[model samples]
Target: MEEKLKKIQQDFLNKTKDTKTLAQLDELFIALFGKNGQLDELSKQFKDVPKDELKKVGPLFNQIKQQLEISINEKRGTIRKQIYQSLQNEKFEIPSERTGRKEKKGHLHPVTQFEEDIVKLFEKLGFVQTDAPQIDTDYNNFEVLNIPENHPARDLWDTFYIDTTNYKLQTNKLLLRTHTSNAQIRILKNNKPPIRVMTLGRCFRYENADARHEHTFEQFEIVYVDKDVSMTHLQYLSEYFFKSILGKGIQARLRPKYYPFVEPGVGVDASCAFCKGKGCKVCAGTGWLELAGAGMIHPGVLTRGGIDPDQYSGIAWGVGIERMTMLKYGIEDLRSLKSGDLKFLGRF
Candidate 1:
């Protein structure tokens, strides 16, 4: 057994010296040390050896195994360093052959471009752009917006609430804001009226996405507050904005709609540009495409914002930027806007 072990050790040293590559070293290592390998097969011979020799053979076997492992590791490092130095000394150049394809240039995403255009239009109308946190308190998101605790309207927003105990928010409830209209409450609280401000940002809800709906989406909300702000002003601004996007001669229609924060609310619709109000699939054969929800701010919401509702009136609207972009560009699927497909976005 002693003679056999010495022979195996000499063979290992010779093999290690000749090894020129990591792959070769690895193959040698497995043949000697791996399961069912040379060392493993040799260890089995202990049963056949005389009992008097067993103790000496076992200790020598373990020592050889440990030393071989260290030697192989050091050799591996040396080989790797040599390979790296060779690579560093080598020179390379690009092929001179022409591919004949023009490199593509990147442009703003359709959603981003749409957002910029909307901002420019409102800015022209003297509306200042503003932003609010995506994660917000229940009070700012719901209570201050007239959606009282356990109100049926709360069901309208399938909310995604954050764990307040885990997040340590000041309020017991924290959530991804269901609507950008929460900004209205925050704005009114911090600023004095004769205020014209717009918010364009992302909102979240628990939704099953389809052709027209998404779990997460972008929204644009504008709030205007001053004395004697009437529905006529709302109508005029809505029409002017739609015309700017949809081209001249386009018209807007307003029908009575219910909203928690707005009194005498309206559903704003535009004549479908695709079918010219003659009914089309884009408009779902209705000839009118719903654009936004707008109305006079409810006195309760105004008073909650620190403004005297009796002394002042205001109009507010929340529009889906995706919906407007789809109508303008004749896009059929809402999912495509967020699909992350460069091919689809490159068209815009």
Candidate 2:
């Protein structure tokens, strides 16, 4: 088995060397890894190996599979680069005019690019990206985060709920998440203290579409927990994010606000880059544009998350991705980010 594995590995590597186009590479990939393919057939023969040789066979086969996967990925990158470069000098028929010059295939969407930059920024501060269900239980989305039934904060979100009649569950038991804050309770409940995690994804709230708001949007939130956590840490994170993304000249400030999951919540603002902190119409003469909301986690939320409220504290900071991207790129309408206009997307 070991000898056959080594032989197949060598043969496949040689076969891959002969491929050029992505389509060819993809076909080669399936020939070796697909159902009833070389690797798959070999895997089905594991039982035929003697018990004494089985351990050796498993490890060798796994190592060779990993090596092959890595080689194919490297080749895939090379071929993609070649295609992109070659297309630069090639021309194709355009859909409208019936003829046009060659164009680069595509790019990461502006929102995706911006999200990646923010993820990198937070990773430097020991925060790793994590996820929660976009369709989550009301318990996790609201109750666990301390916004219980009839709470004034519940009115803040115009939620879209899932009907449970067919599922035999209670009404409003499951729904599209309104914000990324649903990740906080899961992170806290599942991980030990000194946790630093961020989540970025689609969040929905029923709204009348306009320049300033949308029914569906992206949200980015970070949940931090540990000893000595306080407002100062939250402030530092806000300032660090705005400065790193908006430029070092911009400044951040906090105004007292209210949130059920947090104590002494504050509305976060950054000095208007357009006015350089001087009053302007863009900032509504305030010289500060409201950006995010953050605060030290409330003891009730900490207790609910199974953390000892007396021993540890936390911070929850969240911002709208569209809003941040708009601010950074000087985009006027929130709807434009999702308009799917080639002229707008091509600009990036």
Candidate 3:
């Protein structure tokens, strides 16, 4: 087994030496480390060794595995350096703007435009814009927000776990945040009461995509904590937001729902803008479109945030920017907001 490992190591080393472009390195990486690759196939043979022999083989196997990974990384760095050094020898010219000046107006992406409008509206309501990490620790994203590991509620979000092998000495479980609410714990722990902060950014979910869904999407969430905060405030904010965006006639209703992080959770739904509360495909024939999830912050969650639940109450809610944009523009397909086609984007 040791001899075979040494042979494999030498072979990969030689291939690494021959590898040039980053593309070639990527393909080589798959051959060596990807699923069902050379190393994986070899590791399967470990069980064949006697237990006494297995103990000796295991350590050597690990040592070679790490060495190969380091070698690959070093080769990648050398290639990148060569590319940058080559750029230094190359020359380029920028065309004079005055010589071929033509007016070319670029349109803001539909999602960005919608997000900006929401931000401005929140600013009026004393909500300061804040930013949070798109990639965050699991403790912040789920456990601290009242969704602990193995909780059925965790199934509500299909989270993307980070590949930590490349991250040096990382101990904490990390993931691509499934919701902007990942910022909720951060906001509460860092800020004192009367905190009205909103965060807007990209969220990732490992889920199938269709016309109305995306694997990656934009989300905006507000974390509000203050003395005597109540469900009334949540309702008011929802109604005010819907009326402002969809005209004063638009009505928003709250229905009892279950969200692990909040007490008395409610789903905020709005009368269908397309069918005027009548059944339609856009509303899934429900006469209302689900817009946001919200509720009074659970006492346990507040305690974890270093806040005395007895003194301060809180509310948290999040909205999908793409969905709101769709409602505002009478867009039928959520996919269109992200589609790069000029003909579709030019309209907005």
Write the residue-wise lDDT of candidate 1 on 169-216 in tens digits. Answer: 567778899999989888888778899999989999888987678989
A best-first ranking of the candidates according to their TM-score comes to 1, 3, 2
Q: Where in model 3 is the C-alpha error above 4 Å?
A: 1-104, 152-157
Estimate, for each residue in 251-321, the C-alpha lDDT of model 2 and write its tens digit: 88899998888998999988876677787665778877788989999998889889998999999999988
Candidate 3 lDDT tens digits, 25-84: 999889989999999999999889889988988999899989989999999999999999
RMSD of each: 5.4, 19.1, 18.6
Show where candidate 1 strays beyond 4 Å: 1-97, 165-167
Task: Predict model 1's lDDT versus the native.
Answer: 0.88
Candidate 2 global lDDT: 0.87
Q: Of the candidates shown, which would achieve the greatest lDDT relative to the real structure? A: 1
Candidate 3 displacement at residue 327 in angstroms: 0.2
User: lDDT (0-100) at residue 45 of candidate 2?
Assistant: 96
